[model samples]
Target: MTENLKVEVVGLNRVKGKHLVAQIRLSNTGTEKHLSWAGEMADRTRPLGEIKWASGIGVLDAQARTWLLPYKPAGSPCLCSDRERDGLGQFINPGQSINVYAVLPAPSGNPATAIVVTPLAPPMLNVPISDEAPAGDFPDPDAEPVTLVNRRLILPAEALDKSEETADDGKDLQVNLSSDVLFAVGKADLTASANSIMARTARLIDASASTTVTVAGHADSSGNDAINEPLSLRRAQAVERALSALLTRSEISFQTQGYGSRRPLYSNDSDEGKRRNRRVTVTFAKPAPATREPVATTPPSVTGLTGTSKAEGQPIAMEIAGLRRLPGGLGLLTYEITNQGSAEARFAELHHAQDWEAYKYQAASNVRVTDVAAGRQYLPGRLEVPTDDGVDSYCACTDVSGIRINTEKFAPSQTREFFNLIALPETPGTLKVKIGPFRELDVPVQ
Candidate 1:
C-alpha cells in the first residue's frame, strides 16, 4: 500500500433533471512513490442497493503519485438494463498525482455520503469535495481534456408492473391522469370518489419501489392566484400523503410541488373547462445500476388546446380533446361548446361567421357535416360576410331559426357538442381553433 496516496472530493453541484456532479483529487504524501485507487460513489439518503458508475475518465499521476477524478451520481433502483461496471484500472508512478470528475442524478435535499475510495491495500484516503481546495490553481496545458460519454436510460411509464419491482435506475417516467378524476367542485380536498383513483397511483409506486416521487398539483384559471396557488399545493400534498400511506415501503421517497394556474389542462371559462384543468401528476425515477443497457420505447402522448371566441353579444366557448391523426391526409378536430349565462346560443349564427369579426367567410361555401344529433346541431338561415382575417371559419348548420339550442334556462352547467370538417390550410404552422369566447384549442398540422 502507498502511504502517500490520498483521495479527496473537491466540488459538487445539483443540476436540473435531478443530476449530480462531483470533482475529486488523489494525491501522494511520500516524496518518492507511486499509487493507484478506485471505488464507487453511493448516497446513503437514497435506496441502499441502488448505485451505479458515472460517466467520464479516471485520472492518474506518474510522479508525486497523485490523481483527480470526476464522476456522475445515479439515483436508486435503476431502470436501465444495459449498464456496465468497470473497477479502477491504473498504477501511479513515483512523485506523480491525478484528479477525477463525474456527474449523476440524485435525490433533492439529500447529499451523497456513500463514496468509498479503495486503494486495493487499505489506508484509503477519500475526502469529501467540500473539504478540499480548487484544482484550477494548478494548470496543466498539456493535459488531455477528459471526454464524457453522454448516454441516457429512459424508463417507460408502464415499467412499474410488479409489486416488488423498484425503479432505482436514473431514468425518468411521467404519467398524467385525466382532470375529471382528480378534483371536485370549488374544493381542494380529495373527494371520496377519488380514493380508488389515488389507490391505483399508490400501487404504481409500490410496484416500482421507486427511490423518489415528485407530485405536481395544478388548477384552472377560474379563481385568483392567491386562492389557487396554495390550493394546488395542498392538492399535490394530499396525493403525496395518500401514496405514502398506501406504499408501506420505507425505502421509497417522495416530494410535492404546486403550479396553481400556471399550468392548465384546459381554459377556465366554462364548468367543463375548469373541471379539465384541475389535476395532479406524479413523476418517478430510480437510480441506475452499473453494467446495464437502457431499453427503447415510444414517447408518451401529450394533449392540450388553445381557444378564441367571436364578439357576439353572448359568450362562445369550445373545448376539444383526443386530437389524433386520421388514416387519410385529412385531420380530425372535435369540440364541445357551452352557454353559461342566461342567453340563447344559436349555432346557426356561429355557422355564418357572425360571431367572429376577424376572418372573412366566402358566401355559399359548401360546409358539410358528417354527424349531428337531433336539435343539437342547428344552422343559421342567413349567410354572413367575412369581416377580417382573424375570424374563425364557419360551417353551415341544418337549423336556421335563432332558437335556444342546448341550454333551456341558461343554467351554469350547460354543454353542447359540435363537429366541423376543417380542410387544413396549405401552409405550415400551428392552427389555432377557436372554441368559444373564452376557449381555443391549438393543433399542430404538420
Candidate 2:
C-alpha cells in the first residue's frame, strides 16, 4: 500500500495481439487525509524527470521470468498515464479514486494471466487476461501504439546467478579471479596454482558466443595509481597471454586493461572489500536466447505446515501462506510472521547482511527456495544496479519497508505477510523453502 492507497485492476487486455494495456484504479481509502503519489511508481532507471507517470508499472511473467516494462516508442515517453497531461494533478483526496494505465509488451506464449508488479504493493497474482481490444479512451493515447509494439525485447538480465567467483547476468558472464589466487604479492607472475584455474577459464570462454573477451585487472585503494596501475596492467597482460595459448578458438580476440584503484566493487573501507577489489575479471557475452520457445507450465498452489522458531530468544511462529508459480521460471512465496513474545521482536537475522546497503533492511533476501526434484537451490531474485565504480546487486523481491507497518520490529502478537520472488528452475513436484530460524517446509509447485 502506498500510504493508504488501494489498487485494483480494472482490465488487463490485449490490444491488437501486440501490447497489454493495464487499466488500474487507485483509490484513496483513508478517511482522514489526501494521498500524494508524485509518480512513486515510476521506474527509477528512466523516469523521464519524475513528472508523474506509470512507467514503473509492469507485468511480471513469472513463468517466462520476464518483467515487461511499459512500451516506449522510438522517441517518446512510456505509453502510460501522465499525471501532468491527464489532469490528475498530484493528490487523491480522501475517498477519491482515479484511473491509470500502462501499455506493456505482451508476455510471450500469450498466457491467460500475468502477475502485476507494482513498486510499493504486493504482487497482484493471477489477474485474468483478455484478448479483446481496450475499451474507451486511453490515459495516454497514441496514433499507432499497436504498430510500434514490435519493438525488440531488450530486456534487462532475467537473472543474476552469482557464485563465489563468478556472476552471470543472462547476457554477460563474468569470472572474477582473485589476484591473490593467481599471482605473487606485489608481482604479476602467476603462481603454480594458477595453471588449473586458467585451464578452467579457457573452457568457459570456449563455450561462449563471444568473438572478443575482455580481461581487466583491478587493485585495491590502498596504493596510489602510479604504483597500482602498471602492476595491474602487467597482471592483465599475463592473464591474457596465458589465455591466448590455452584457448582453442582461433578467431577469438582479447582486450585487456587495468583500472588500478579506480573501480572498486565493494567499499574500500573493509578488509573483505579490499580483497575483493584486487582481482582480474574475464568477461564475455553469453550464448543467445534459445530458439526453442520456453516451456509453458501452469503455476501450482501447495499448502505448507505451520513452523515455529525463535529469533533473539524471542518466540515467533511462521507458516507458508501461499506458494504459486510465476512466469519466467520464478516462484512467489508468501509467508506469515507472528511475533509470539511479550515484547516487540526483530527477526534481525532474517536478511542478508551484504544487501543492507543497497536495500536497507530487506526482510526476505535470505530466504532460499530449493527445487526438490532437480536438487538445485535458488535465492531470492536480484537485479544489478550500475554505479560509477561497479554494479550493486539488490533483491528483486519485496523488502522490509513494504512489509512492515511503522517500524522494523514486529510488535507482540503482530502478524504480517512477507513475499519473496524466487528464481526457480523448471522442475516438477515440491520445493523446499528455507527461512532462517524456521524449519524448512516442502511446498508443492502449483
Candidate 3:
C-alpha cells in the first residue's frame, strides 16, 4: 500500500452468477488533495467496476474474474453506496476515509484467491499560463507517479449468498421523501401519512450497509428565510425522532439538519412546486468494513424489500435556488421545480428538439424583471436549463417551464431540478426577478 493512498479490501461477495460487490476503503495519508468525484459532475469520472480488455489495462485478478460495471442493477441489493447522492468519485481530505460501493462483473473464476486494484492516476493540477510560460509549467518527465495496491482476500466457496460481518465501501446514499406526506402548508407537525413515509424510509435506511444517517429538511419559499429555516429544521427533527424510535440498531448513527426555503425540489410559484419543495432528504453513508469481519446481521427489512427508483418527475417551480449576475453581461439563475402534483405538466416541445424553448405559453412570458428602484421593466431573458448531466432519468428536461416529462411521467409524486442562464441585459443596481404570476426575488448588483 502506498503512503499516498491505502486501499483495504475487506471482503468480496458474489451478488449473483457473474456479478460481484467489492468492499474497499481508500485512505489519504499525504496532505496533498486526493481526487475522487464527490464535488465534480458525473461525466468527469469513469465508473468504478467497468473493465475494458480492449484498453489492455484495468482492474483484473489472477482468478480470471473482472469487474465490468459501476451501478447496482435491478436484482442487486440496495447498497448504501448505490443510493448515495450525486457526484462521481470524490476528493478525500487528509486523514479522511471514503467508502466505495462498486459493482463488477466476472466471466467465471475464484476471486477469493487474490484481489488486485489498479486506480487511475490522480488528476493533474492546472498551472496558470502567462505571456510565455510559468516556471513550473513542465514537470520532470522522468518522474514516476505513485501506484495504489489492492487488498488481498480469501472468501469461502459458499460466501456468495450469506451476509458477511464486514460491509466494505465508503459512499453515501441519498433518499428523498415527499414533504407532502410529512406536513401541511405553514405547519411543521407530522401528518398522518408521515408515519407511512417514515416507515418506507426507515426500511430503506435499515436495509443498507451504512452506519450514519442524516435527515435534512427543506421547505418551500412561501415564507421568508426567518420562518422557513427553523421550520425546515423542526421538520427534520421530527423525522429524526421517528427514526430513533423505529430503528432498533444502536450501531447505526442518526442526525438531522434543516434548510428552510433553501433547497426546493420545484418552483414555489405553483401549488405543485410548493408541495414538492417541502421535502426531507435522508442521506446514508455506507460503513467501511473491518478487515476479516463478516456482516453478522442485516435489518429485517432488507429481506422483504422490493426495489426503489429515485429518478422520476420534474416541475418548473417558483422557488429560486440561485441567482447571480455574471461578469460579462448575462445572469445565471438556478432553481428547483418538480411535479408534486398528481399529473405531468408539459413546459417544452418534444418534436421541436432544436426549439427547446418553443411553447404556446413560454416561461419567458411568465418572466418579469424590475430595476432596483422598481420603476422600470427590462427585456426578458430566454430560459435555458443547465445540462451538466443529461437525461438517463425516467422523465427529463432543462427548460424552466413546460419541462416536457413522461419518460417517467410527472408521476403524482416526483421532483426534478433545473437552472436558467438568462440574458440579464446589463441591468444596474438591484433587480427583481418575477417568474410566473407568483415568485418575486431580488438580485443585487455589485
Candidate 4:
C-alpha cells in the first residue's frame, strides 16, 4: 500500500504555440494517514524551473487516489507569457486519502529528458495530529507500483532533431504541418498541385536512402472523432502512395495512421480554424549504412524578384536566392526579406508573362507584413518563376531585411530590399524594378 504514495503523469495535452498541460495523479496506498506531500517537476535534458505546488489534493482514502493535477508547459516565451503562471491554482488535503493535480509551464527549449514527479515528504504533525503515523507500521510509502502511467507530450515538428537516431528503431517522429497545405473543403483526395509539391519532398527522402516513411493524418474538430479518425488515416495513406510514386524508390517502407479529430490544429468552431486543422505529415527513417554515394548538394543562386505595389505607402523589399533554371526557358529563385523600417510592408504584386509582354506591366497581388520586432531573425521565404500562366500567382513571403532604420513615428529610414529574379533563358544579365521606395534586384538566371 505504501507504493500508492508514488505519482504518475496520466495524461498530456498540447496547446497551440508549443504550450502543454499535463494531468498527474497521486495515490496514497499507505494505511497510515499522511500530513502533507509535495512533488517537483524536473527535466534531465534541459533546465526546468520550479513549478512549486502546481496542484495537489491532501486527503487520501487509504487505497484512494487524489484528483489529477494539471500543469502548463511550453517550449518558448514567444509561444506564451510567463505571466500565465498567475492563473495557476493549488489544492491540498491531509489524512484519509486524496489525489492531486499540477500545472507546469515549460520553458522555451526543446527538452529531451523525462519529466520526473518526485514526492517531497510525508506528514509531520507538530500538534500531535491524528494523521501522523510511523513509517514501518504502515506500508512502505516508497514502493514502486506497476500500474503507474507516465507519458510525454511532444509538439508538432518538434521531433526533427531525434529523427536520425530513432529512424531505424520504429520510433515515431511527430510533425504538424499547416492544414492549409494538405486539404480542401470536406475533401480527402490529394490535390494534384499538392501531389506535385510533395513529390519534391519524396525525392529528398529517396536521396537520403531512407528505410521507411510514416505518414500521420489529422483532422479538425468539425466532425465527430468516429468520422474524423478514419478520414485522417485515409489521407495519410493517400500521401504515402503519392510520395512513393514520385520518389520511385520501392525499397523504402511506409506506414500510415489516423489521429482523428481528437487532435486539432486550431479551434474547429470557425471555418478558418477548421481549415487549419486538417493536415497529414510525413516522417522518414534512415536505413543502415550502405555503399551509396551521398546525395549531391548544390547551393541555389538568386534569380529574380516578384514585384508588387502596396497601398499602405510603406517601403517594401524582397531578397531572393536558390535560383535554378527550369525546362521552358524559365528560372527559379528563393530569398529572404525583412522590414527594416518603422512602418509595416507586404507582398503586393508579381509580373506575369502576359502582363510582361502586353504592357510591360506588372500584375499586382496583396500581402501584408507586420509584427516587426526591433531585433529578431525569422525564417526565409521562397518564390518561383516563369509566371504560371497567372494560375499560381500568389505565394506567401516574409519580410527579413533590416534596411529601413528610423526613429520617426511615420517616416521610414533607408529600406533595403532582396530578391531573386527568374527570367527567360536569353533575357539579358538581370532585370531591375523600382516600385515605391524599394528597389527590386533580379539576379541572372542560372
Estimate candidate 4's RMSD in Å. 21.3
Candidate that beats the other on TM-score, 1 or 3, i.e. the better one: 3
Predicted model with the maximum lDDT:
2
Local accuracy of candidate 2 as per-residue lDDT tens digits, 240-293: 999999998889998999999998767788777787789898899854433434
**Candidate 4 residue lDDT tens string, 1-446:** 01234455543333332323444455544554542333232211112233233332111111111111222223231111122343322322332333333323322232322222222222111111112221222111122221211122211111122111111111233344434565565567776557545765575576565677778888877668888888888788877777877886667788789998776544566765565456776676422223434333553345445443342565444444434433222233333334445665443343221111111112211111111221111111112122335211111121111111121112233332222212222332433323223454444434
- Model 2 residue 102 CA deviation in Å: 2.5
Q: For all the candidates, what are their Cα RMSDs to the real structure? A: 26.5, 6.0, 24.2, 21.3
Q: Which candidate number would show the highest TM-score if scored against the true structure? A: 2
lDDT for 226 (candidate 3) = 90
lDDT of each: 0.40, 0.70, 0.43, 0.37
Q: After superposition, how far is residue 354 of candidate 1 from its true place, in Å?
A: 25
TM-score of each: 0.29, 0.70, 0.32, 0.32
Model 1 weakest lDDT span, ten residues long: 159-168
lDDT (Cα, 0-100) at 109 in candidate 1:
34
Error in Å for residue 372 of model 1: 26
Against the hidden true structure, what lDDT does model 3 obtain? 0.43
Ranking by TM-score: 2, 3, 4, 1
